[model samples]
Target: MTIPEQIEAYLTSQPQAKRTDLRALHALMLQAIPGGKLWFEDGKNSEGKVVSNPSIGYGTRTTTYADGKTKEYYQAGLSANTSGISVYILGIADKAYLAETYGKTLGKATVTGYCIKFKKLADIDVEVLEAAVKDGVGMTGEN
Candidate 1:
């Protein structure tokens, strides 16, 4: 299926509350990065074994490893987990940025190096989350 179709399917598979939150987040991400690329990963390995939760992704970034290998990946990602939802802001150079900048201000969410996780949208400040996403996109020059 196409990326949009896969994203829709992934959102539709969530519990009602999570589905609603994911949809809202999807819209917010779109607003943050207008015309950004979209992606959906079914969380499968080459063998088709389930390796992670399905994720909906936005924007693009080219990551270069120390070994000089590079990969093009999403700049941001959204996913639903058994306990909550996760927002991934990829390609940040400073590993301490997210936690240092948004960890306390993002309400009840857990802010890590590249991920902001919360149980629900209501548990966090959407505006702060938006700012974090915007910063992430800007940092990657993807916005």
Candidate 2:
């Protein structure tokens, strides 16, 4: 399936309440980063073991490993996990910036180095989340 199709399938597969929440988040992400490349990760390793929740991603970034190999991934991503939803902001060099800048204002979410997570959209300040997302995109995106 295509990336969009995969994302729809992933979102639709969620439990109804979670699906509604994630769908809203997905739309928010799109509005935050319009025209960005879309991506879908099935959360599988090369061996087909499920390593994480499948994620819908936006934009692009090239990630380099300590071994000097590189891989391409999205700058922002969304996923539904066991407890809640996670929003990932990749490519930021400062590990503490996100949590430090937006944690308190983000409402009930947990702001980590690269992820902001909450049980549902209604639990957080959507505007604050949007600002954080835009901030992350600006910090990590190619100029």
Please report the candidate that would top lDDT against the real structure.
1
Least accurate 10 contiguous residues by lDDT in model 1: 134-143
List the global CA lDDT of all models.
0.91, 0.90
Instruction: Give each model's clash number.
Output: 0, 0
For model 2, where is the 10-residue window of minimal lDDT? 134-143
RMSD of 1: 1.0
Instruction: Write candidate 1's Cα lDDT for 55-131 as tens digits.
Output: 88888899899999998889999999989999999989899999999888889988889999999999999999999
| Stretches of candidate 1 exceeding 4 Å from the true structure | none
Tell me the spans in candidate 2 whose CA falls farther than 4 Å from its real position: 66-68
Instruction: Tell me the deviation in Å of residue 29 in model 1.
Output: 0.7
Error of 1 at 138 (Å): 0.6
